[model samples]
Target: MSRPQLESDVRSAYDEVADSYADRFRSIEPEEAIDIAMIEHFGSLLQAPKKVLDAGCGAGRMLPVLAAMNCDVEGVDLSPGMVRRARRDHPSFTTTVASLTDLPFPDSCFDGYFSWYSTIHLPDSELPLVVDEVRRVLRPGGVALLAFQSGTGTRDVSEAYRRHGHDIVLERYNRTADQVAAALSVGGLQEVARLERSAVSPHERDGQAVVIAKV
Candidate 1:
């Protein structure tokens, strides 16, 4: 499918189930360890009161953790319902309905940007534009955290971790570590670390590689 169609499908899919999906993964336990590692990583590079934008922050699960760390955090997601849930659940932080392809904030508005597993929905052709948006919104010397499948395949809607809840139809743009690194470089980001995390999904279950980049 084309990039535009892929984006539309993604938005529609998430919007349809945003409420229930948010309720299901609303808890942060599954990602606690990863979030902790990310906090440690961010804390090492940024200081208190640093501004952060959590791209694709579904239901605002990571807001409180970042807020507790003394960072000024904000979240954005493609689904309006998800934004609504996030706002209701995390009144302490700010969130809005927006897409990674076109962030609504001004240039250099944040000191750090984190996408978690958000960018996985973007096709390879469109991924650079999203990354460019990240770079455009981040201040110089900013950092980013992104996660995606590691392999070679272009996938349509797919299921994963069924035990977690209803089957999620997430777009899978499985790419190699090197390809991802090159794509990151295209958006003016340099690699900080690449981690491979184990999964309970049908895809390569061994690990989900994450790349930390600096803008």
Candidate 2:
């Protein structure tokens, strides 16, 4: 499928299960301590009163985490329904409906960029463009944190939502830490740190990874 079609499908799938998704993942879970630690490390690397963008911030779950770190955080997601839930759930932060490939922000405006399990929907061929857009919106020395399942190939993740009574088709494309690091490097960002951990939770089907980069 084309990139546009893929994006549309992702948006629609998420929109269909926005409420259930939000209810299930409104906060950080204990199983995600390592992942949350990586995010905290990313927040620590930044200066005070940081301007952060939570790219593809579903339900704005992590917005509070960033805010607690003295960050002036805003969010953007491709799904309007997700954005709406984000705004309703976290009214203090701004959430907009926007695409990762085409962000609605000015150049070099953010001190930090966060994409927590958000890029898993993008195929390998389209990662560079999204990374380039990430580079565009970050200032010199800005930090970026990306969290996703680590592996190779795609998986049908729609069953998770189907179990909650929503029928949606969702495909998640997995990539290695090196693959993501290379994409960031090509987008003018340098890899700063990376962590890959084995899956521990019952819901997890693959290992997870967090890549921290700087522009």
TM-scores for all predictions: 0.85, 0.96
Location of the lowest summed lDDT over 10 successive residues in candidate 2: 1-10
Model 2, span 58-166: residue lDDT tens: 8999899999888999999999999999999999999999999999999999999999989999888889989989999999989999999999988888887888899
lDDT of 1 at 140: 82
User: Per-residue lDDT tens digits of candidate 1, residues 137-172?
Assistant: 988888887767677776665454344454555556
TM-score of 2: 0.96
C-alpha lDDT of all candidate models, in order:
0.75, 0.90
- Segments of candidate 2 deviating more than 4 angstroms: 1-5
Best by lDDT: 2
